[model samples]
Target chain A: MIQKKICMLGGFAVGKTSLVRRFVSNVFSDQYQTTIGVTVEKKCVTVASQEIMMVLWDLYGEDEFQHVRDLYLRGSSGYIVVMDGTRKDTLQTALALQQTAANTVGPVPFVSIINKADMRSEWEIDEHVIEQLRDRSWTVLFGSAKLGQGVDELFLNLATQMVQRPPLSNTHP
Target chain B: MSSDSGRSLPNSPTSEGFTSREEDWTQLRTLLLAPEQTQLDELRERLDHRMVHSQEVSQVLPEAIAIRGVGDQQLSNALTPYVENGFIAAVRKSPRAIVDAIAPIMGPAIRQAIARALQSMTQSLNRSLDESLSIRGLRWRLEAWRTGRPFAEVVLVHTLRYRVEQVFLIHRETGLLLHHVATDAAVVQDQHVISGMLTAIQDYVRDSFGASPDQTLDQVEVGEWTVWIEQGSQAYLACVIRGTPPASLREDVHDALAHIHALHANALADFAGDATPFKATQPYLESCLLAHYERPPKQGALKGWILIGLIVLGVVWWGWMAYQAQSRWSHLLDRLREEPGIVITQARSMWGDYHIEGLRDPLAKAPTALVIEAGLNPATVKMEWAPFYALDAPLVLARAQSILRPPESVQFHIEGGILVATGSASPDWAREAKRLAVLVPGISQYRDDGLVTASISALLDRINRTVIHFPSGSSTVEPSERVALDTVAAILRELDQLVSQSSQRVHLEVLGWTDATGPPARNLQLSQERAEAVVAVLREKRLDKAATVVLGSVRPLDQGGSNQESANQRVATLRATLTAQGQDSQTADP
Candidate 1:
């Protein structure tokens, strides 16, 4: 089985932990993120007939007071940036965290998720912003953790990308 | 050198004329120094070909390393990080493979290390014990006070009072379980979750305190369980213990963690939730699953023997008491059965007391007194004796003597079922004894062969012999005959009193006889009057228990030949008799 470490990075209260909860059958509680700045969950996803064990590291949401620790992002094969659709500034935070994840783990595969898609009417993120993320050849998907929409696809897409990509070279020392 | 030569070659003119000359020059060069050029070409080819270059370097690398190693430490210093990193990477890739490859080498070294560690631990333990009351002890006490640990806990730690119940080898980076080993009796939860939580807690402590990454939370205690975590470069071992662990136990745990890290470095580094690779660490982890329970403090030999002696003494005392009670009960029962006039029917011991129920003659000895004689408490003996009359000879004779109230001169004895009397008693007593001897239960008969009556026999003889004279052909007594009749009446009264004292009655008979001086009818009438007159006088003297008989000329008192003799026959006589009260009388004549 192929194993990949996937970090979930995003802004504060952007439903990053909820999205991981919606994706993986986890034994650890969400309070781990609040306490330790990271919570790890594992799920076996078969991508294109290959069993890929994706170990998801859901990092505590970064805010003014706390920043995502680089220690948690070490050895990540890919990452996902979660943005709350109701908060446009969360999109900027997600983009900024995506940059930090890239610098920390070095050019791994990543996907952008605009969460709360079920509340489309309340979405503050515009199509242009989504378009700009797409223009960078970055994969941007819409999902809602509460509604369990696109949750499977969000994690599976990252797992498949990690499996198709080259093996990680920038792992922890 | 390759970079310098490549730069020179590029600058060496790559035009068409230069290219043709280059080939011509190469041919000319090959022809002039063919063997040398062949050697040069081979050299160039070996440098150009990756495989050939690798083979060439492989051939020389050993010698070069050997030479450089002997010359200085520079080669080793330069290669150390790469070798270390490569080793780390290899272990990370497949720890099992690395362990398998190095097992032949690591086995003895690990054993030696373990032996050394064990020896060290033993020495430390001995030292701790030796220093328990010395200066080190005072220091330990001070440490306990400073560390806010109980003195007992400190002592237990020194005494090695703990068992390593479980060991968890966890991935350092991902917080995943690498492997777990536990004692058989340990309660195990999901090791994966526990590993993650342990990592999270460590991370939380570190992050919360802003401690350096190198600093780690080493120990966690909850109730009686303590988790001691030893951090290594790639992985950390967490030992779960059930008591205050000894300092050497932590040291041993640290050694085990270090061994596991050295052995499974690559596997831990590359561990991605596939903990199966870490199974090779089982022996190491299990080794860390050590236990050092403080043995009960050794007791002095004298003290132990004293304890056993006391217990034995108690048991022996109890057994002796029981035996004594049982023996006393048996002896008491035997005595009771042997006692005369006592019949033992039931005997048993109940509730620490001897209960005896039997039939006992009232005159028999009390069983409780026998209980005392047997050296047992009377209160501990219960006796239920139903009164019975015994046929034993002594008891029967006693009964007879008690009932008859014989005089001192008379002694009663029993032979078999017969009550015999010896010596003389009053006739009243003798007669009364004859009647009442049958009342004693054991006496079936009464014998008085040797017994004599005291008074009543002589009195009877005097009364029977007395005679009263009457005048011829008259039914009256003279004054002298009356006096004689009064004396006989007094004798009769004495006999009646004696007989009355016994269960007997007395009777008297009076007879009148006539001489040949009157006709037969007149004589009979005269005799009848004389007897009636005698009886009438005796009746006046209170002798009413009498009867009259007249023998008028039919039978005279005497058969004499003269009238004077016949005149003596014309008399009133008295006869006396005695009989048992319910029987007919027997005559007594003198």
Candidate 2:
């Protein structure tokens, strides 16, 4: 079995922690408590008849904590940059975080997850943005942690990719 | 020595009493100089201990648990025994009892220490009162004071006493006790001496006023009275006095008492020491002071006018700021509107070659300009100009050229400034050719006759547009032409509204013709089909559908000299006829 270390990163209160919780434990918390540091959880997924372990790291979501994000991304095979669908600035922050992670992890696969998908009426994330990111060869997933929608599929897809291509060397087992 | 003066020898007890009185007077003098010193030192020590203990407690305990202080009830309970035995005289006591009993028991040194302590305590209390009694604090204190018992009960009582005496002094010439409280139920033994003092005081006031002794007499009562001298009715001098004097000689006594009170009050005003004349009345004086200092009621209309003025000024200021902001925003928008091309160019630079559809040179010439113009860069092109149909094909073709390259083998035929081009190219190459055709200047029309041999799917789009048309007289279309016809219909509707309204009835005529390559009958049929195609669109536009008759002119019969001329001859024409109804007819072409 192959295991992939995947980190979720974004700005403060953007629901990065909730996304991981929705994926791993199938739970959502509405209360927004600032994450002190980083939280790690694991889930096993089966894709195309192959077993893959996804070790998801839910890092603290604050611009101030961005300096330490690379350390979390160091052993990761991929990342999911989360942003609130209602806030455009969070998307920009997520993009910056994604770039930082890519630089640190040496071209690790990444996806942009526009969370809070239930709020489509209030969504600031436009289809043009998705097309642009997709053109750049990064997957874009719109999801809602509260509804538990698209959370599992996002992880499973990333896990399959991880199994097919291992992370850059020097990653811990 | 007494035998020559013929007075009886005084008893030992009487002699002792006289000597004791003399000793008492001496002690009083000493006590007055150092009154309450010991008590004051003890109080200072206790205060220091309390402060230190409170600091320690505050350090040890949580903020919520720190104790405030002993309550008044508890303090009063502790002092009850001393007070009962006459050790601690109530504040109501006369100056005599205060001097005699208190001085002997506490001693001059202790008395002095207590007085100093009390004085320092009073000063500290006053400082704290000044510090704590800010307007807000005083408001809160007053509210609490009114709602419940006074929070500072002891201080309030002391203040009351001082204020009452001050009031009494203000009315001193009236010979009335404005305020007083009895220290003991029983009268003092020196009644005669007090009476004699009253007589002397009355005589002094009568002399001062130059009034007869009997005429100056006024109301008299025990311990206080009022006297008046006849001057003017309002100008008469009234005196109020306090302390006991004889009833039989009360009229004379009232005059004296009035003189004494005025002298005492004046003396008090002149004295630089801390003691206030207000303190003479004891417990009721603080209330009097509060009443004396109470603020007068504010005028209603003045306050209301002030409030209105402030509100009006605020509204004007806000309105001015908003107006300025709105003007600034509009100015920025106006600047943006003036440079449409620049804005589009900037957007293109920011986003790169993405959804910018018609990225083309605007100087291009081509026919079916509408479809070609649709291909122009949506990002780089702003919707600033009212689009002319003649420019559409040229603009679109230019855009297509930017996206795709044409094949090398493509050729062109130019006749009378009209260029005809055809080639077998890839779908991409055909798109590029269309784009290139649009870039050519003065070319009015185009036909997509070139074949895309490699992809049937690519040619399907062009086939679809050519086959679509509107239903009839409604400006709406058949389901097949729904999307494209809707866009055209919207433009036509806008044009219809934009044209002059006073030109009477507008008549639209549809004519159709066909190519000369076919047999006569077939060419005639093809021409009819072309004619119907245009008539159908006119009918759908709701533009005089009855007037929109299809005129079929077969190709060879109507052919011009060259293929370009012949193609022009094969064109469909939709003419608008304007009838003036009651006036002369005026025709306009759109």
Clashes found in each candidate (C-alpha, N, C closer than 3 A): 4, 67
Q: Estimate each model's TM-score.
A: 0.47, 0.22
lDDT of 2 by residue, A1-173 (tens): 43455677888888888888887778888888776556656676876555555656667785753444344465456888888989888877877887788777767677778888889899887988878888988888888999998888778767666544523443233
TM-score of 2: 0.22
B162-269 per-residue lDDT for model 1 (tens digits): 878899987787666778988655789866657766777787788778899999898999988999999888888899998887788878888888888788767776
Q: Model 2: which docking level applies? A: incorrect
After the best TM-score superposition of candidate 2, give how far the Cα of residue B116 lies from its true spot, in angstroms.
89
Clashes counted in candidate 1 amount to 4
> In model 2, where do residues sit more than 4 Å from their true spots?
A64-68, A171-173, B1-590
Model 2's C-alpha root-mean-square deviation from the true structure amounts to: 47.7
lDDT per model vs. reference: 0.76, 0.49
Docking class of 1: incorrect
Model 1: residue B452 alpha-carbon error in angstroms? 3.7
Worst 10 residues of 1 chain B by lDDT: B546-555
User: Which lDDT value does model 1 have at B130?
Assistant: 54
